[model samples]
Structure formats: C-alpha cells, structure tokens
Target: MRKEKRSSKVKDALGSLTQDLIDAGLGSPFTEKELNYYGINIPEIKNISPKKIKVIREKAQFSQSVFARLLNVSTASIKQWEQGTRNPNGATKVLLDLLDRYPHILDYRINKSKRKNYI
Candidate 1:
C-alpha cells in the first residue's frame, strides 16, 4: 500500500524477487533503503492509548503478571501502560503492535505431562 513513490508494477516485481531470493536461502543483497524504494516497507508502530492497552490485555485473557512474563517486562510496566503513566517504545512497541493485530498470538496450550511441549 506504500507504493506511491514508485510504479506499483515495478515495486511488486522487485518485492517479489527479493522475497523469492530470501526464501531460496540466498541472503538479500538489497539494503534497507533499497528495499524501501522497491516498496517493501515495514509498518509504522502506532501509539496505543491506555484504554486500548487494557482492552488488548483483557482480550488476550492474560492477567497482568502473565502478560508481563510473556512480554519479558515487569508487572509494574503493564500497570503503567494501562494507567497512562508510561508508554511502550522500540521493540516493546513493535511487539504490542503485533499483539494488537493478531490477538490470538499469545494463545498457547499447556501440556502438564510434557514440560517441553508447553509454549
């Protein structure tokens, strides 16, 4: 959708070729700037409000402690985010965006009999 800077047909061709090369185990030769010119863009992370953060957590059915553990952050951080006292940034923001888009990403089944099988 961010192909406005270039011809869409050209961008699509280059993007597809780049992806195919990566999938075939040949590392990408294109730089990030080059990829962007080809219209292969990463989505920008949107700022999530306190209420939305609370909604996302509740929708995932995780307690603050569990969500914090999954995100490798402190329970206090979750509290702050939900209370509008702080904001998630960088990698945490990226992760939160992914969670917002894919609500079921955190779903996992516990196999009590096989510890290794638990996600």
Candidate 2:
C-alpha cells in the first residue's frame, strides 16, 4: 500500500477503536488495569521525520538554536532530532505538533518577545 493510504487506514482504525472503547464504557475509567486490558495506549502523538523537523523549523524562520529555545530543549537535542538520531517525546512532541499545525503562533511568540524588550 502507499504511505498515505496506509496512514489513513491506521487513523481510521484508531478512530474506530476509540469509539468502540468509549461505547464499551472504557472512557474516563482512569484505571491502569482497564487501559492495559483494553490495549489502549492513548499518548497518540505523530512521529515526525528528520527532514520534517528541518522543514518545520525553517518554515517558522527559526535557527536551530532559536527553535530549541522555543521548544525549551537543548541545541544539541535539536541537532540530534533534526539528524534523525532522536525523536521528540511527551510535552516536547505536543509542542512540536502544535507548531507544525499553526506556524503563525511562532510569529505571535516572536512579536510578544519583542514587546518585552521595550519594558
């Protein structure tokens, strides 16, 4: 199958599984055993490639150091991420997803920082 088709299938499966879980009274159960038993690991962040990392940073007009600062990670970590040696996880992954989805937020952040310099 093509990459895009496979991804869409996986997304549809996940959506169906989620709905099934909800229908089965698993939603908001908040217990480890229930989650484990249902085979539901819900930290479903997208995995991005090294090239994508560079593209996202460049689209936001940020250098590696600046992008690292924005993401609150080390410059070395950014380098590793962009080199495909590392993958972002947890809160960093969440932030990167947000930035990728709404790049204008970076402009807003930059403007906010400039305003701070006047104070």
The best candidate in terms of lDDT: 1
lDDT of each: 0.82, 0.77
Question: TM-score for all predictions?
Answer: 0.68, 0.56
lDDT of 1 by residue, 1-119 (tens): 55675577777888989878876968687888987887666568887899988888888888999889888899999999999999988998887877887866866633346566444
Candidate 2 residue pairs that clash: none
For model 1, the stretches where C-alpha displacement exceeds 4 angstroms are: 1-12, 16-29, 109-119
Candidate 1 lDDT score at position 77: 98
Q: Over the full model, what C-alpha lDDT does candidate 1 score relative to the true structure?
A: 0.82
Displacement of residue 80 (Cα, Å) in model 1 is 0.2
Q: Which whole-number lDDT from 0 to 100 does residue 92 have in model 2? A: 79
Q: Which lDDT value does model 2 have at 9?
A: 84
